[model samples]
Target chain A: MPPSPVAVSAALNVVEVAAVLAFAISGLLVAADKKLDAVGVCIVAGLTAFGGGTVRDVLLDRRPFFWVERPQWLWGVLLLCVAAMLVLRARHFAVTRKAILWPDALGLGLFTANGTQAAIDLNLPAVVCVLMGVITSVFGGVLRDVVCNDVPEAFSDHRPYAICSFVGAWALIAAEAAGWSLWASLLVATALTASLRLAAVHMNISIPPWDAGGGGK
Target chain B: MPPSPVAVSAALNVVEVAAVLAFAISGLLVAADKKLDAVGVCIVAGLTAFGGGTVRDVLLDRRPFFWVERPQWLWGVLLLCVAAMLVLRARHFAVTRKAILWPDALGLGLFTANGTQAAIDLNLPAVVCVLMGVITSVFGGVLRDVVCNDVPEAFSDHRPYAICSFVGAWALIAAEAAGWSLWASLLVATALTASLRLAAVHMNISIPPWDAGGGGK
Candidate 1:
């Protein structure tokens, strides 16, 4: 039998928390690379961790925001920010270009699945659900890059970021259609998304930049 | 006696539509300045026209979005964008730096008052209501500049943008406290915001940037 709704919700919360941690770490690394102060780091980290889900909730008209409803998640992100900042400072670690990839991949996969699930629960159109999943996975990083005055990697880098989320979201939908259990669907989708992102990064794979002759300018 | 709630709401809608038009124009100018193609222009214009109110609605838990509920607003912005694009193309008009200021100021005033009134109708705390007002006024332009890969003038320029909205929001709140009619409050507040913004621009008034040693890093 499928798991109880309550069981599924609790499991989803755990996954969300992990994703938040991963996103927070990526935010901190980006802030450090930008040479931001402590407050800037905190702001970037908070925005990166909460931005995507906040946007999704707003789009779905969910009241009280996710972090507002569960203050613990906000607190968890704050705690992680402090810990990560301290560790980086103590070790005098220089942030490398690849530093954000692993955690960002984890966050991308988890958030994509969770966002898709929430839209499914709301009975939105399938296309919208998949789009929401991609938005939830990528918008935080987009916001972070924008705030830091860099071109949003999502729009400019020509990377496979949102594409990975898109495919993974469909995978989850397909799994459910194929009569897979909720847990099985979530696990498989998340794994596929993370693996795709990691592979893209490791292999330096990217979509081609829009050509000047393509009417982009 | 104060204006009837229905009368006030109708007036507010008129003001909001005007603001949306102004904001859309500014977005188009910015996108054109950046030499974005037609699709990019449409995206930026739509974002600037809708982004702030959408953010406010999300934060306030208002459903369906303002444009989503009244798709006429969406249509209106699109029409304005197309019209402006054609005019600019036919004339080969260069987008001047000064072109965005007037419409942007008008939008700041109108959106600030409308957002504040919406929060008051919800009976939120006064400070939060004022904050919602400022946010609704400024966030769209911020999003536009960021997407265009410019430093958000709201954060970096210190040219009395958000500060004007802040003061005007409080003016509306204070007028209400003193038993003014809703129309009176909105008019005075909008006038105050627009005048302040215009004066700041004409006078070249700006707050000094934070000192390099102030630790913003």
Candidate 2:
């Protein structure tokens, strides 16, 4: 039987809210690092928090995005952003440029997992689900970079394991398709991606396409 | 009866492609004015062209957005951007800042109409459609401003009639819902919006409160 409307809505709400918080924190940290004023920080936070979900919905042919449907999601993000700014202010702290990777990776992992789950719930094809997961995980960062007047960091050569999202998302999709429990798939995907990214960051691991002479047979 | 999927897709493809080119050209003009190098110009052009639709899709809860669905669209945009750069190079042309408004207004009108039509097709409420239309038309410019490291000119006092989008989109939605022909409604809306914007530019008229506040409002 089809899921009841209320159940469906509840599930969507839970996932969306969780994902929004994850992304918002990521944006907040980035804004802090950039030393943006409160309004600028809030704008970045809002964009990062909603950017991925909005992309996911538009691609899935969904309408009146979650934020628009329940505007409370936006309000929640706004409040969290304000709270974050206050906390920073109270501590008399400033975020240096060096202080922003962990939260971003964590946010990426959570968003990817949530997007994959949303796709699976919608009964999308496996490839599409994986794509959605990756898009959801990355588009917000892309938007953030553009706003910051930088090339999308994901596409830059210095980025490490940025593609981890696609790898782990595909793995999660496979696991779920193979009958793994939802939470199990989510945990595995999130852990796999985050760990890979952290390790890559620490080890200075890099992808191999730079050597022009190596490609020829 | 449901519309034939093939026909719908075909029409969507044509209109969307046209819209993308129009906006890309507008972006190219802006970048040319700034004397950005090729990479910068391409980035700006692509951002300007796809930015609005990307916003629209996300807001509407769509997934695997049009660009993602067809990676070829990215290639097309890239090629056009390259061509634009070559043309500018060959002619040693300078894009005067003053030359941008007409094409920009045209792009805004087309995008607004297309966005509203998409929302209406999705059966969204009229209010939502008007909002979507405005978002689709203005978001690219907003992103452009952000990338250029400036406040979106629209948000600043110098620009007025940006809200013409909100007004015209609503007018179009009302007309269409009242059983006006699609072409007639679209043309009327676009003409009205473009005229109002051009007049605002010529007359140096501005949005009332925003224009008068002079910042820090």
Candidate 3:
């Protein structure tokens, strides 16, 4: 039997919170690497955790942003930033390349699933729903990179980051079409996306850069 | 006598169009400088023209973006980009530093006034209204710079871009408090902002960087 609507909603909320926490950690690590001040860390962490959802809500014309409606999320992100900063200061914790990957992948999967569902709820077209999913998964990191004066990893990293999100969005859409429960679909999609991202990272997979020479690379 | 409501509305529309056009041109020039492809040019120009207003609308929960409602604006920007590209290719029309300053200043002024008015109409808080105005005037350029892999001129340049917008927003608020007409308020605010920005550019005025040392520079 399919999960009840209430159960699905609760599961999704858990996923959202987990995603927010994971993304915030990734952002805090980047800020620490950049040697930004306290304010910069807070700004980056907030943007990384909430920026994509904010963009999705704005595009969908949803009032009172997700964080705005749940002010606790904002406070939670703030507290996390403060704690992380103190922890980093107290002990010389080196943020290696490997440190951020797991959290980033988990956030990407969860956010992609949630954003796709949100757009589906709004009755947007299928393509747009998928696009929103990709945007929600990737744009926060894009904004974080941009603000930190790094080339947006989403655009230039040549990785499977956005591509994985796109595939997972389709997975959710397909599962829904097959009449699966929302929670089941979310689990499947998130697992697929997260595994694919991790696999890509492990294998050092990459897409070629867009050729400037006018021929498709 | 104060301008009629109809007249004020019409003038604001005109200002919006002019600002969009000027900002689009600035974006196109930047794309050309970076040797981005045609698609890149279109994306940059579109973002530079619409990004700020889109951000303001999203933050304020306004539905159906301005360009989404009036797609002619998007078409107009496309045409402008095409024309500009052809002209630049046909003749080496150097896009000098001076070439961008005037239109950028004008767009900054007009957008600041219109954004402030929009927030005021929504009855937002005074600080939020001022911030919306500044975001409307500057966020587009910030987005364009980010996409082009350049440091956002607004934050790092410290050349009074957002400061001019903030001052203009306050000017409009002050004019309304003094019982001035909408048209008069807009004119005063725009002139003040544009002039200040131009003056800053001309005089090479810049704010000091945040002191990394213990001492405030």
Candidate 4:
């Protein structure tokens, strides 16, 4: 027999809360690692937590943004930031937006896999699904850096940020095409993205900026 | 007599093209005024044309973002950029992000009115309506500045950009409440917001940044 609708909803709610917390912690970790001001920290935390999912929901035409539907959870995000700050400070984590490279890479992998999986579930077009995955994983950190007044590290750091997520999204598609189990596909994609990001960072991989033009304007 | 569905659709497509052109021209005006790089100019133009509506669509769960639905318009945006660039080049307008303040003010009002009207049509909550208005008017510039690697002048320029739009959104609500016609309400809101923005810019009105805290981090 199938689970009751209420039971499924309850389980989904638990998963969502856990996902939000995880995403928030990644932001908090980045904030802790960076030298962002208190306001910057809060903005990064909030954007990191909600930005990607919000974009996905909007693209999919899902109503009542998760954050909007449960505004109380926002307070939870704030408190989590406070708690993360206290703990990270106690542990003497380096704090600066630059530290974003670490946790952001992990987030890139997780969100890329999750977003791609979501679009796949919806049976969206292949290109659209891949784009959604990329948007979900990359947009949050982009917002984080934008608000913090930096060229988004995802775009400009001479790094392979979006590329890693892009590849990871494709990996999910490949995995499913190969008849992999859903859980296995998700894990493989996430791990592949995260590990690739880590490898890129550790190896100091680079991508050049675009060429300048007439009047360079 | 009621128009045929095809007739109405054709008319809407025409209106959409006109609106897109107007929005694109506003961005071109800003790019023409500012001393931005070529890439910056293109980014600004594209964002100005599509940013707000894309955001609003996402929030309202409207599907196939206008640009997405009709990818051809994207090429039009690119061509528009090219044409605007040449015309502005021969005419010799100031070129710098600073030029953003002018056309941006006009966009603020127009998008604010349009966004608010869209939300009002949906019968969303009042606060949500106001926010949608603000997002539609302000988000494009935010994206433009972010991509240009400048702190969004909308937030950091010590200006009343968002606030002006905010008030304009409310004005639309009030106009509707007072039984104004839709066109009248839209015009009133747009004119009010744009003029307010102009006033703020002309006066160099400012808002202070948040106070720094422990570690100033």
Cα lDDT computed for each candidate against the true fold? 0.82, 0.72, 0.82, 0.71
lDDT of 3 by residue, B1-217 (tens): 7566677657767888899999998998888889999999999999999999988887987778788878999999999999887767623546444588899999999999988888877666565677678889988997898788875667555577878888999999999889988888889999999999999888998754323211211
Q: Return the candidate ranking by DockQ, descending.
A: 1, 4, 3, 2
Output the better candidate (2/4) by DockQ: 4
Q: Every prediction's TM-score for the first chain?
A: 0.91, 0.80, 0.91, 0.78
Each candidate: how many clashes?
Answer: 0, 12, 0, 16
Clashing pairs in 3: none
Predicted structure 2: lDDT: 0.72
DockQ of candidate 3 against the true complex: 0.10
CAPRI-style grade of the A/B interface in model 4: incorrect
Candidate 3, A46-132: lDDT as tens digits:
789988888887778777666655667877897997776555541333433466799899999999999898888777999999999
The stretch of ten residues in a row with the least summed lDDT in candidate 4 chain B is B208-217
Model 3 residue A55 distance off true place after TM-score fit, in angstroms: 5.0
Residue-level lDDT tens digits of model 1 in B73-184? 6667767866666555523333334666888899999999999998998999999999999989999988888788988779888789999999999999999999988889
lDDT (C-alpha) at residue A167 in model 3 = 98
Error of 3 at B94 (Å): 10
Tens-digit per-residue lDDT, B1-217, candidate 4? 3345565445434434555656676676666556777777777888878987887887887677778888999899889788767665543554534565555566677778877876776677676788788778777766666655655556555567777888999999999889876667777887899899888778776654333223334
Worst 10 residues of 2 chain B by lDDT: B208-217
What tens digits encode model 2's per-residue C-alpha lDDT throughout B1-217? 3346665566556657777877887788777777788899899999999998887876666777888988898898899888766655534444434566777777777777777777877877666687678778878977877877765555444445447777789878878768876667777777777777788789887543311112211
User: Which 10 residues in a row give candidate 3 chain A its minimum summed lDDT?
Assistant: A88-97
- Clashes counted in candidate 1 amount to 0
The better candidate by TM-score, 2 or 4, is 4
lDDT of 1 by residue, A54-138 (tens): 8887798767877887898888888877887766662455443456678899999999998888787777666667767877888
Compared with the real two-chain complex, what DockQ does model 2 have?
Answer: 0.09
